[model samples]
Structures are given as C-alpha cells and as structure tokens.
Target chain A: MSAQDTVLVVGAGPAGLSAAATIASMGKKAVIVEKEDVLGGAPIISGYAKLVPSGEWAKDAIGRMVSRVEGDGNVSIHKSTKVTQVAGEAGNFTATLSNGDKLDAGAIVLGTGFTHFDSINKPEWGFGTYEDVLTTTQMEQMVGTGQIRCPSDGRVPERVAILLCVGSRDRQIGREWCSKICCTVSTNLAMEIKEISPSTDVFIYYMDIRTFGLYEDKFYWKSQEEYKTKFVKARIAEVTKSPDGRLLVKGEDTLVKRPIVIPMDLVVHAIGMDPNALNPEIAKTFGIGLEKHGFIDRAEQYTNSQGTTRKGIYVCGSATGPETIDDSIAQGQAAGSRAVADLYGQQKVAS
Target chain B: MAIHEKTLIDPDRILQHDHLVVDGVDVSGSWNTMITPRTLTDYEEHFEEIIQSYSGGENVHRCWQCGSCTNSCTMYAQNVDFNPRYWIYLIRLGLKAELMKDKDIIWQCVSCNKCTNICPKDVRPEGVMKATAHWLEDNGLTPKTLSTHFDEEFTHQCIEFGRIEDTEVMVGFFKRSGQPLVQAWIVEFGKRLTKRLPLGQLAKMGMNVVFRPKTKSWGKTGEVLAEYVKAQKEAAHHG
Candidate 1:
C-alpha cells in the first residue's frame, strides 16, 4: 500500500476507536495500538457506572464503539501493544509497535487519553492508607459491584464524603488546571450512591462546582432538588480516621466561615485527570511539542482543536487535555477527516 | 495580601504602611496590608475539654470546621456574628480571648436546631451553643445570659419536680435574668391570656401550679439523674 493508504491511530480508547472507524468509513486502512489487552480505555478497565448528560450505562456506550471498530474490515486493532518507535515527518511516517510490527501510514493520530491523577501524591487525602478512602476510579469500581460499602469492613456506608479537586487546581502541587469532569463525576457518584441506598447521606466538598455548559449544570441542580444530595462549600483540608475505623473529614465551610468535622464511613477523593505518562515518549518519537502541563499543544487551539504543533500528526481527546468521551469521539472524527484530506491530496498527486 | 484566607488574619496582626515601597514596588493600599506573623502562646488549653464537659460539647473535637452549622444557623441569619462554627473552632484551638469577642451573643442561639439538623458531622451545634453559654457563666467569663438563666432554672425545676412548670420557669427565669415579672409586655400578654381564657380553664391552670405535675414512676430516676448531673459537673469543674 502507498504511504497515503493507511492512517495510524494510537490507543484503543473512545478517541482512537472513533478515529479508526471514521477513517475506515472513508475507504482507508486504519491501524490502532493500545497499551492494554482491552479495547476500551481507562473507563472500560476501571468499569464506569453511568455516562453523564444522557445517563447511559458506560458499559453499553463504550461497547457500541468497540463493536463499530471491530466490525470494520479496514480497521485493525493491536491490543497489548504500544508505539515503541516512529520515524519520518508529517504526511509520511513509519511506526514500530511494541509487538515489533511496523506500519507505513499517511498521517498519525495520538489519541492516547489521560490517566486518573494518582491520589497517593496527595498524602494528606489518605488515599492508599485507609481502606475506605478511595479515588473516583476505585469508587467507580465499587459502584460497579452494586454495593456502597466501606472497603475496610464491607459494611454498608452510612455516610460518604466526596472531596473534589484532589490533585488538580492546586498550586501547591504544581497542577493549576481544572480537571473539568470531577464536579459532574462526583455529583453523579453521590446520586448513584443515594439511589442505591437511600439511607446513605452523600456529601460533596468542593471549592467551586463547575458544571459547565447546559447539560451538566442540570445534573448538579437535580442532585440538590431531586436527589437531595448535599453540596458543602468546603475544600476539605484533611481526612483523619476515627477510633471506630470511620473517616473524619476536616475543612472550614467557606460560606459560614465555620470549621466542620464529620465522621464518614467512606471518603471518596474525586481525583482529577493528569496527562498520560506515554505523552513524553510519544512527543519524543514524533518530534511534537507538549505543553507545560505535559499534554500536546494545539497548532491553533481555536481553529485547529485536533491539529497538533506538528504537521500530518494530529491529536484528539484527553491526549491534548481533559475531555469527555463524547468530545474524544468528536476529536477522533475530526482527526480522521484531517488525515484523510491530507492523504487524498497526496493520492491525486501520485495518480 | 497574598493570603487566600483574609479572615484568618486577625485584627492585631494587621500591619498597614502609610507610604512604603517593597523592592521598588509600591504596596500601599487599603487592601494590600501585610500581616505581622506572631507565634500564638495564649491558647486556652483544656477549652475543648471544658466545653465537652458540658451537655452538648462532646463532638466539638470532631469538628473539622466545615461551617455548615453557621451557614444553616438561624441566629447567624439575624446577625452574622452569631457563628457556631467559629466558636467551635476557637474552642478547639483554645483561643479564649478570641472567643470572648462574641460572648454576649453566644446565648442568642434560637435553639432552632437548624444547625444540628443540617450538620454533616453531627456537631450538634445547638447543644454546643448552650454548652458554650453555660461554660461562659460557669467560668465567670460573663454574667448569666437570659438563656442560661432560663436553662438553669428550668433544669432545677426538672431535677426537683421531674417536669417543668411553665409559670414557675417563667417566674424563676425573669427573676434570675434581672427582668421584672410585671413588665408592660408581660402585663399585656397576661391580660390577653386572661381575657381569652375561661374561668374554669384559669382555675385548672392555677390548681395545676399549686400541685405541680409529677411523673408517677419518676420515684428515684429524678434523684439519680440529679446526682449524675452533679457528678458530671464536678468532673468537668475538676478538669
């Protein structure tokens, strides 16, 4: 096949899957590489409960993307692999995968999505120390099991506190960007816990609730009016343990200028998204620029949201920044279109 | 002020410069005052313990300072100075002098239990308010507030008669609070009560006052409870 025939897509998450499917529909070969043995990304492996806006089951939503890419003959998914090496620039590139397979493609798309911020980094949150102390990923896994219980004793959690911005938006830790999804996720998880067990009092402590846009703001308000979930305006300072294995969260209620201490059965840290670790290696291989925060910078963020600093190579999804699944898919389609357009011009020249 | 918590800078720590430049940058403004950092050594140790010794201050230590109590406080609505969460914080830190700033209004809590009902940490701030008020009087930090006088006199009746006599509680409370029983409002209220009530109902109310209602089975429970209260007070006092 010619260099313009196949479009290389990295990672098999929603972004990569959508990119590959879009390229495949354009009658071009699409190759996808993932670090894990699974097709879906972090959400699939961690096991999410529900998607926001529509509130669809994450399993079914992600399953649809998996099937779309799997059914396409033009698309090839290489699971349990990663891009080990890349050569050439822009329109023509050769990538050597961890599986030792090489591919010559017209354009490259890095859809390597973000990973959850490690809660261990913020020791004050007491993430790994307390069995009942969990991050959103762990809480999602627990929620998948269909029971809200203290991880320490397996007893039902009478009270659960979700603290937002665990690792994000804190100048002390060098992360000044908002993760953008924690507010919605924390709210949804609180609602889910309350729905699963009505007796459970779910409290969310946030510096500010940024349920941006139309849909997410509705869910936040609905949490207060419909679900009766309590939103406390206190960024918790510390999580200490009680004598009875319960967690004590300490923070001042900024609204009342009062200090509060409450014992909780479980403490869920709504950790934010950090740039994927593979970003540095990928940037090194492809000769692209990464922002100070480690995510790839857009060539022109306003006009070319998916276009990276390097020509022919593009980026979509959380590879560039914190993005929802829907946004990742949209970026995937845009990257596919950009790749196909570049390849089409080259194909005409070759003919 | 580079400080995130502006309120944390107490009044004494404020340092205002009339006309000063720091590293060639003029930092003279109404809002740009600096704080003089000072190590605190005047914390009232055992303040939390003493408050906890009272009826409702048991969970004061559990307070992480979320301010939910003050946010939902009924008294705070009337006057922002009526802050339960702030007092709880001061009690925990043993900031006795800082707490004394709001001594008079500490007893202004309406006992609405809004703070307690909405407290995420179960701080039971209504109880804390009473406890703090009692603490203030017990320590002679302030004179007995009307609420404290009312509570003590009411509790005395309960300890003695097993139940509260509304009339006796009112009379005892007014006398202890230094308010005359026959005030203009009280006489008007009494006139309204007497004008609206039938003679038979009035007679029954008078008879009930003469022979106070006693719990038939509260034979030794009252004495036991009174003794228990006394022991608790002694323990707290010793602390």
Candidate 2:
C-alpha cells in the first residue's frame, strides 16, 4: 500500500490496534504512531494479569488483536515515534513524526486513550504514602507476577480492601464522571484475589456497583455468589495505617448506617480514568476541541460519538472517555469505517 | 422574587400573612410565605469536643455526614426524624441549637449496634446517641429522661452489689423511671413467672433479694469503678 492509501493512527492501545486492523481489512494502509516501543498499551505496560469481565490473560486477549494488525502488511508500526505536528485537510494530510519522518494519510484516528488517575492526588487515600496502598493497576501487576505480595512486607496479603471511584465521581477532586470500567474491574480483581489466595479476604467498598447490562451477570454476580468477594456498599473516606502496619479502610456500611474500620493487608484504590496529559497538545495538533473534562470532544455525542469537531480527525476508546476493551475495539472499527468513508467520499469501497 | 429555600429555618420563626398585604407589596403568591431572618448566636464552638468526650461519640469527629447512619438506623426506619447523620453533622458544625430540636427522639436509639458496625468512619452513631443524650442532661437542656433514669438506677445497683437481682433491677428501674410498679404488663409477667417457677426457685428469688447477691471479691473493684466513672463524668461535663 502506498502512503496515499494509509490512515494515520496515534496510540497503539487496544483502540489503536483495532483501528489499524479494521483499516487494514479495508485494504487501506494503517501507520500506527506510538510513543512507546511496545504496542499493547496498559495491558502490556502494567502486565495486567487478565482482562476483567472475561478473565482472559491480557497477553492472549490483547495479543490476538495485536497479531491481527501485525499480520497485515498494510499496517506499518512506527515504534517510539510521536506525531509532533500535523497539517492539511480531510483527504490529504501530513503528520510529522518525532524521528523527522513525514507520513501522508487520508485521515487520522486519535485513539490516544487515557491515563490512570494518579492516586497521589488523593492524599487521603495514602496511595503513594503507605506501602500497603496500591492502585488497581499496581495490584493487577502484582497479581500478574503470580505473587500478590504486600508492598510493606512482601508477604501474601491475608486480607485486601478494594476501594471504588478513587478519582471518579468525586467532586472534591473535580472528576464527577464515573470512570466506566473501575467497578467491574474492581469486582473482578476482588474475585481473582480470592481465587489466588482463598484465605485472603477481599472487600470491595463501593457506593454503587456500575456493572451495567451484560456484565451484571458475568462479573458482578459471579464475584459475589461464586467467589464470595465481599461487597461493602460504602465509599471509603480515608485509609489509615494500623499499629500492626496493616492498612485501615475507614468507611460507613451504608446498609447498616454504621462506621466500619476494616484492617487489611493490602488496600487497592480502583483509580478512575483521566484524560491523557498529551491531550491538549494532541487536540491542538489536530485542531479539534477538548471536552469539559479534557477528553477529545466529539462533534455530536448522540449522533456521531467518535467524530471529532474537526472534519477528518476522530477519537475513540478512553481518549474520548473511560470505556471497556470491547467497546474500545468496536469504536476503533467504527472510526476505521468512518475514516474510510470520509477519505473516499464519492466511493463506497477501496476500489 | 428569588426564593431562598431555608430548609433549616424554624417553622415558628417564619412570618407568613394569611389574608393581608405587606406595606402595599401585595405578596399574594407563594412568595407571601416569608421566612424571618435568623442570626445564629448559640453555636457552642467546642460542642463537638464534648460529644467526642463520650465513649460512643469518640469517633464522631471522623464523620463526613454520609447519612449512612441515618439510613441504616432502626429508629430512623420507624421515625424519619430519628436521624443520626444529621445530628452528627450538627455536632460537627457546633450547631447546638439545631441539635437540641431533635433532643426528645435522640434517646430513642435502641442500641442495635447496626450503626456501630456499618459506620465507614467508625463514628459509632449508636454510642453518639447515648453520649448525646447524656450531654443534653449534663448541659441541662433537658431533664433526665426515663431512659437515663433507668440507666442510672441499673448502674447504681450494679455498682453497689456488683450483681443485680433481676426482679430488683426491674422494680428499681420502674421506680426510678416513675412508672407504676403495678402496671398491667408487669402484673401479667409476675403471674406467668409464678406459674413457671417451682416453690424452691421462688424461695431462692426471695432469698436473693433479702441477701442481695454480691460478687465474692468485688469489694474494692466496684468502688474503684464507681470512683473512676464519677471522675470521667466530671471531666466530660467540665473539661
């Protein structure tokens, strides 16, 4: 495929990889420009133990999509390259790579996904201060390493408390939007921890379980009934350390209207999704708009959920907002088809 | 007129005209319901400290007013006015006057331990209720309610004998609380008790009241406990 037939894809996460595959399948070249050397994004960087909801090993699940994109010769992998500058119109554009390589494409897909909320912003959570305090990503890394050890003593935790909405849905921190994936991911992690160490009691403190639709039965129900992952309906106020060096999860049991302080060997903060720090630069590069909360603003969320305010530029997956892996992949494909249609306005097929 | 919804305003303080005009303003709409401006001059700056001085109210300072306590409260289920969360909020803010409005129902906490078990901040609202009721009595905002009298009578007997004869406690509590000792329920219970108990057991009960059962080595323990309690109570009220 010539440079004229290629589509520029920024970010090599699930969204970018899926978009590359979809574009490649349409007989159009996909040039994936990733800042990182590796392609699989968080799942690979954090070495996620398994994809939540499905329980598939991160390598196997994301690897399949990665392989599909890599298998196609139409996909060009630009490793450790960043799109420093972009210019031109819908059907004819040039993106200058960090390596001084210029790539010309018909359209651009800004699937530059999201950054995990830096739990350090919430000092009350003790995320970085205490050794026992771990973010959901850190916890997943520990689980992936085949040893869920406490950061304090390097011993397997006897009990763990997973707190939901650490950054999301908290007005104090100014993130009122619910990070759509944390609840299901937290519940899933609770169950996984239970499975890994049955003796390790897992407690998930949540205000509301947002395991909506299909995940209601698969993740939430199974975590509760089958795995016995204890769900406490309370948003934790703060995490303190016990005299014995264990983490103390202070929260009210909303159901019983009483304060509960649970001592835990490990406290996992299911930190919500935050827009990537590179969002402002990327938005400026594409001449697109940013949402109130800083995600790439879509032209019309109800009608065109993935279309950016800029004509040929689009965003998908967590770059727009927190989304599941499946939703990211599907939206990637949608962006691919939309780009294909936009690039070839008068024609239906690649021909 | 832009209306300010004063949810916390005193109903009696609100001056609403029935069929008259206010200085030719003809406030005929719902705007006619005018709330009297309030100047809160009764905030006890250290009131939360006093609440925390009580055993159950020790964690009251940790409360963020999530309303979980009120939602889970057994009393709140029956009477919505029985709100532990609201009282905790008032106490934290030192709105002593606002807190006093719910003084009558504060003592109705059933000591269910539900509030204690579920408090995320471990406010132990059940204990806060007990402490608050005591605080009210200590401050003389209200007289010693029946529940306080019963508690005092029970504690006084326990301290004196180190053990309470069941009948003695009942008769003592009833007497202290100023309830008729010959109530219909008590009469029925006594009749049933006599019917169920053999003569020997009944005699044992009579002997217990006469001799007054005592913990064998509880001589100085009760005295020490009573003295410590009195000191703590003094400190709680004055310190």
Instruction: Specify the highest-TM-score model's number.
Output: 1
lDDT, candidate 2, B1-239, per-residue tens: 33576556668777766555879877676766776544342234367777878766776766655678888889999999898988876776476766777888898999998888888767788888988988887778877768778788889888998877788988888888778889998789789988887889889998998988788988788889899999987766444
Which whole-number lDDT from 0 to 100 does residue B192 have in model 1?
93
Residue B167, model 2: lDDT of: 88
Q: For candidate 2, write residues A1-351 as lDDT tens digits.
A: 444577899998999998889888898889999999888887887788889767899999998888888888989898898998888887888889999988898888988999889999999888878988989998888778777788877888877889899889988888989999998998789888887787786767888889988887688877765665666667787888888787777766665454556677889999899998889998887888998999888876665657898877778788998888888989999988778766676423321
Deviation in Å, model 2, residue A8 alpha carbon: 0.7
| Weakest lDDT window of 10 consecutive positions for candidate 2 chain A | A342-351
Which ranges of candidate 2 are over 4 A from the true structure?
A1-4, A347-351, B1-239
TM-score per prediction, in order, is 0.63, 0.61
Clashes of each: 11, 12
lDDT of 2: 0.81
Identify the leading candidate in terms of DockQ.
Answer: 1
Evaluated at residue B142, the lDDT of candidate 1 is 82
Q: Report the C-alpha lDDT of model 1 over B69-155, residue by residue, as the tens digit.
A: 989887888898888988887776576776888998898888999989988767788988988988887779888657879889989
